[model samples]
Target: MRAELFDPRTEAVPAEWDKFLRDEGAPAAWDAGALAAVAWTSLRTVLLGVVADGGQAVALFCGDFGSPRRRNPVYSPVGGPGRPGVYFSRILMGFDEGFLFATHLDHAGRVAARRAFERALKARLGRRCLGVVYQNVSAAALPVMRTAARLCRPVSPNTVLVNRWQSMEEYFAGLPRDRRRRLRRTYADVDADSGLRVGAGVPAVDPVEAARLEQLTRLKHLSPGEVLVPLPSLYFERLNHRDGVRYFVHTDPATGALLSFDLSFEHAAGLVTTVTGSAAGAATGRGLYWDLYLREIEYAIERGVPRLEFGKGLVELKARFGCVTVPQYAVAAPL
Candidate 1:
């Protein structure tokens, strides 16, 4: 097997890269265009492609090389704080869920591909490279990952709500009595506020306001001393026009003020909620946050989406809202 690296920002990724993802039933996050969107804005992003005999593309891995200017949780805390000239490569850059596979390969073949990719990564990033980190790895892929890296630990669980009910009313009826009562109260409060309305689909959002709200929500959840690179307003503006991405927005009707927004990626497999934020000084305790989850659930149910992935964080809280926690792991190997 041979491994080759391509900078999606400058090089045109081979068509086979995305074909392999589709044939293997990969998620929307693995889409070449989506990855390129992120890569264009990131400091350094690379795609690792593995090919077997006869030049058959066996695997494609995407990630970003850590930069001191932008410290991301995926790579920073895993190998210590970010420092100038100290770098690590983190696979699965754009999304925080799912695992990779060397498609159409057996155990031994898969292991070899993993090893080749690692070798290429080390060669690409020399002595300054601290390690290669794989984040949000699922259980089934752990064994293969362990073959190349000894460091592995459980991170946050990815929350998913498997839709079973036929409709929103059916879903509400099925919830526990206490939860049902609280949900009803929340709905009533939201309904009474004629000024606030929840709508789906991408709207012409003000990039500046949207970025501001997203940063506020992001900072509120980060652990102390942890640093994250903030996505610029331009990124949001570009995503607004991208297909397969939509926003569930809460806005004040009369004033046309954006209150809160939840962004989700629509895929054949399911709906994955991505970034979420609320305007600063927005009224709290009115169930606005909870409404986002409920609206996402309703949207999924309406579309017959099998699952609604809420991503990581707030494990217990998400569980109470009928989401199941899927354990996620991170593996780090020093170069």
Candidate 2:
């Protein structure tokens, strides 16, 4: 019943922050509109509230992180311990030095929510610079965050586990039709090539310019970086300033030129392509990225959107339309 600091004029704290990250069960990007659009994780919009206590309601919530080159070993500011969901991605600044990435929190004992999140990170950054804050694993979360990161002791902490697909055509009819016929002959040879007019839109989304931030850093070398641009291009122009999101582009009507793109979000089934890009040298057609991913999966089934996640890696051209292969995990514990 302590810790506090959240305040964006605080009114609709997303129904108490999406019921405290869904009762802290841990996913859906830690609910409440992904902690209100991550704003480059300034300790999650400068939050610090942990409030609720005794009766329970207070597992954790912290803030005040840094980046004066985070001890300067290479560099990776790409968002903080990655929050907005399940849990475990520590930096408690005390001897516990936590970590529990990709955690589902394997069921067992809570151990008092692991000593109250390491006693609120050793009472806010103390006790021997407690670093590494990563824990939990998710095949759909709940193992009590791997028994509260082994009761906050010290060993085992490199985590990753948060990718699934229980439905969605059993995860796309489980592919292999010649990798779904080379992903439908690379988008039907980029849609029977004609001036390459493929379709889908959500570009310039929250983006300012520099040609859409160099076309999303050149679509991060498409698949070479394995879908990851999570927010930059000015956080997708700050989710295009409140509109939040939606991404699927492939234009070129005789010269408008834009070829291909994808970066969805309105999830639950229908808007979740995550990241995509293609051009086929701008016109000729080398499979215009499978005709902009089967016209963004037939525009996610004409918007009914019962399914269209396609988040993790390529998985043989997203299992060539039939699209299957659900096993999302990406651990990283060590602070």
Global CA lDDT computed for model 1: 0.69
Most accurate candidate by lDDT: 1
lDDT of 2 at 216: 54
- In terms of TM-score, which candidate is strongest? 1
Off by over 4 Å in 1: 9-12, 18-26, 31-56, 67-99, 102-106, 201-206, 222-224, 283-285
Kindly give the stretch of ten consecutive residues in candidate 2 with the minimal lDDT sum. 93-102
Give the C-alpha miss distance for residue 68 in model 2, angstroms: 41
Q: What's the lDDT for residue 37 in model 2?
A: 44
Error of 1 at 161 (Å): 1.2
**TM-score for predicted model 2 compared with the true structure:** 0.30
Query: Could you tell me the lDDT of residue 322 within candidate 2?
Result: 57
Residues 97-173 of candidate 2: C-alpha lDDT, one tens digit per residue: 12222123323324344445545544444433234233323344333433433433323222111233343243334
